[model samples]
Target: MSYMNLIKEKDYLKILIAGVINRFGDSIDAIAMTWLVYSVSQNASLTALNFGINFVPTVLIQPFAGAYVEKLNHKKILVFMDLLRGVVVFLIALLTYFQCIEGWMIIVATFLLSTAEAFRMPANNALTPVIVKKENFNEAISLQSSMFRLSELIGTGVAGIIIGLCGVHVAIAIDALSFFFSGSIILMVKAKSYLRIEHQNKIFTDFKKGIKYLFHTKCLMRICLIGTIVNALLVPINSLETVLCIEVYHMGAELLSLMGIFSTIGSIVGAFIYPYLAKRYTERQFIVSFLLTMSLFYFICILNKVFLNLIFLFYIHLIISYFSLGAGAAVLSTYSSVNLLDKVDESFLARVSAVCVSLCTAAVPLCSFLVSFLSTFINVSDVFIVIAILSLLLAVLYSIISKKRWLE
Candidate 1:
């Protein structure tokens, strides 16, 4: 029999396309929402709060959501979440276009969107391995990630232009439409979801089991910790990028758009090169070395003083840096599960992935607030230096810890 018969290729392709369409909305919203909040309130704290609200539901609800995703039909759960998000986003788009949207309304929309995402994310992660053959799984995930980056590049670049020409409301409306389109695509996909056993054990028991699995497994736990710290350092730099480009460097949306493009180009390059690198380096060595290199690159980008020249240098640096980052991340994601896929079961997969993503998501808001507040007191360049140093330090610490624990 053909290998194609082993998995639902058509359904997988639909899921990937749906992800791209949905993320176009996500890309626009990332810039538009922050700009909208900052425009209205003219306060850093309020903007930070918007980020905080976006993450709160995922942080609070993810453990339970993980357990819930395992027990349900993953495809149906994905569809329902997308539908809920589409409706919420469409309403926000309407309210925004009418100039009726308020700060609180924006925050509420973020909360709802994140809550839906909290449900959808774990289901999608679990569903992937179910639908794709084990041998092709890495390629599937890499393609998905590269597509996501492409969506980010296109969506954010377009958002910059649209926000400049038509304003934030139009961008928000487009994002809302994108979500609706994504939901429709999800509805078109068909897949066989594995049935979960009726474990009479408590829900917390399932949650704890996932946690215990993570903790007892040295490689997974260390990766999570390293990932969390790396994110903690990285998110603040991103939060400050817009402010740095516009306010400090006297650049505009055009340059910001260029940065997105170059960064994405780097990711595409990285994804393609990853398999080759996998053959050349051990996973741990590759991860730690790349993390350290990216940290240094970020530092150099900030230290370059010439505005236009800095952008050019940053363009090159980001491409290389992101390629490294993507390569490293793929290694970690693959290694997150060491054993045969069948033993961990779907619910366990959901729980572990949820917790990991939740922690990473939670870090962004906290770090954003820290970055914003720090910018008010110190130079943004100084903030970048601090972040770069922290990233380097974390990479070193992670290496030592991994070695001592025999995590490899």
Candidate 2:
């Protein structure tokens, strides 16, 4: 039952293998799905809608997902989710192969996949502490994250060839296979039983209790709010990035892929350095300082686009922006248990995670909608400026309010 021993090299290797398998498959869609949607509809609006529909489920289901995880078996839930995701993605691959993959099918499939993802995420997040030594938790999270980014680097290149030769169907088939690969690895890793706490009350009552606890805990609320505001304000920037690059800067996917590479590099570096940084500063301080640094960088990126050639400055700006994001995220994951982690019973972990997921993702669609609407009137630079301002404001406010409880 002791979680500490799981930090051993052998155990970490097991988790690393699982992550690699999961991320390799998950990376197939970095470019394929977006291209597929556009190919089907040729409408940017529909493409945005397709992306937004996925978040809708996250907004609605995350809290419950977290709660359910706490009350159920985390491993079994992960197994089932992986199995379901594999099936759903396989069907999509079949549709694509038949040349009958419609826009609605993509939307519906995205929603279903996201819904399953919502359930899987909380268990995965909370399960780390159970399997990894508490001290190695940050490293595990960073390693896992880097594995995902690494997979993207490899998968994007691989997807390019697959899409160019065999088309999106084959790429999607690889994605489905990746899921099964990940699931098999997960099934092989032995860990202590992750049973949910038995609650005698009704489901609704239990749900309310988890929600109330999340809001009532000052420290946890602060952490959740920080995550929520950051995602809400920044989601639009990510959603609109491709358009900004193409329409505003006259760039292409190649440059965007380079940005992704730099971002992943920064993440790998940050993962190595953040643990050292954490020993010296509180998580709240790190978040605020990094948030401010990145917000300013984003502003510069937006403004730089106005006077310079897109080719010259675009890569630089993207590198800085993504580096900042990667470093910030690395630090953030280290303190994943801040407020609600130890306070909740094992049974409520899923629900709590779901609520957190809902808050974190709820505004993604709204942000995407705003970007779609705003682009009609304003330039992409204006959109970036707006997001930068929002991030700076939230960062400053969170820092001031959470100073006393920075490390709590």
Candidate 3:
């Protein structure tokens, strides 16, 4: 189906709008939160800790949240999450405005916000299959990815201006309002029963079933393992980009926001192209190729020292690396979403998605901690190089293993 037709579908359209608005808010929140933590603590470790805090709940709470997602109404879950997150962000803004916000408070807020997301994501994922026709799933997913990236691009592009003009508190306040808007939009989505499980099992029983299904499915298992390793290594690099921009590059908020916008531009392009690409390549082939290419770009980025004098050259290299990685990530995410829908029974979908999200993000906090700790002992650039090398090795290993038709 064409993009126009996809948007014409009322339920899908509502979900897309809500997702885009929420992501835009999140992009702004990311900049605001990172800057807020760094400004307060003046410690790179603390900054990294702030980023890692968002994922901690995903790792710890999502597995059980997934089972509950199956039991609850997806629409209600989405609405409640938005309302709860809105209140939390608004409270943070109030604290910031009062000059009472501290690094620990930011961490606490992040943990709470992510807790809401932990429940929201699985329900949202499970709801997609309910709204979109099976034949148009790829197109719908791709469009959703693109919309999300577009929002990121816009939010990041404007975030620096907002911060420079108003303040971090203002950006956060805007984010809080965006959540209300998202919640309101989601309310208009008219969908029937989102839960497919007629008789809900015990939460632990459901969690066990999700875990069993994940392990039993070799293709999904392989994808999850590779994704987890890659995320662990890459997340720290992303978490520290503000440090690199401000401390290492001697740039400011505007430059950091510019970098974010450029990176998201690549992601948007990648997401836009994914539907067509999905039609041509097998999931395994697409994933393998994207990973290898992304790894190569990452390696090339580490060679920035060779052209240190030419700032333009460095920018070009960074943009290319970001674009390649963003595109690869979009493709992989699209594939994974579609694959899960095809493989898991509808009753088990939310729990399975939650488990997968949890596993994929399980190592992020440790990696973030390591990055902050290791940067004190080793050069930050050297730490990134280590991650790049690991990524390359994983890409090659995945290529070799993907020779089996597990996805088939």
Taking the tens digit of each residue's C-alpha lDDT, what string does model 3 give over 1-408? 477778567898999999899889988988888888888887877887777878999999999999988887899889989999999999999999899999889888999999999999999988888888877777787788889999998999899999999999999998999899999999888887376566767999999999998889886786676567557756755788777667666667887787778778877877778777777887667666665766676566567656658988988887777777777777777677767777777778888889988998988987887777887787656776787677678778877776766645
lDDT of 2 by residue, 199-311 (tens): 55655776798788778766666667667656665565456555555666566555555555665666666665665776788766777876786578668766656745655
Most TM-score-accurate candidate = 3
> Would you give me the overall lDDT of model 3?
0.81
Encode model 1's per-residue lDDT on 1-408: one tens digit a residue: 133443457888888898899888887877777777766776655665577667778778887788777888787888788878878877877887788888899888888999999999888888878777766755666566667878877887787888889878877877777777887887786677645666746668878887787677665556566566556655654565666665556666665566566665556555545555656778568667756865875675575555356566756655565555545544444444332243455557888877767765677777766766776678767777887787788678867876764665
Predictions in order: lDDT:
0.70, 0.69, 0.81
Stretches of candidate 3 exceeding 4 Å from the true structure: 293-302, 305-309, 404-408
Q: Pick the candidate with the highest lDDT.
A: 3
- How many clashes in each structure? 0, 17, 0
Off by over 4 Å in 1: 1-8, 309-343
* Deviation (Å) of 288 in candidate 2: 2.9
Model 1 C-alpha lDDT versus the unseen true structure:
0.70
Better of 1 and 3 by TM-score: 3
**lDDT leaderboard ranking:** 3, 1, 2
Give the total clashing residue pairs for model 3.
0
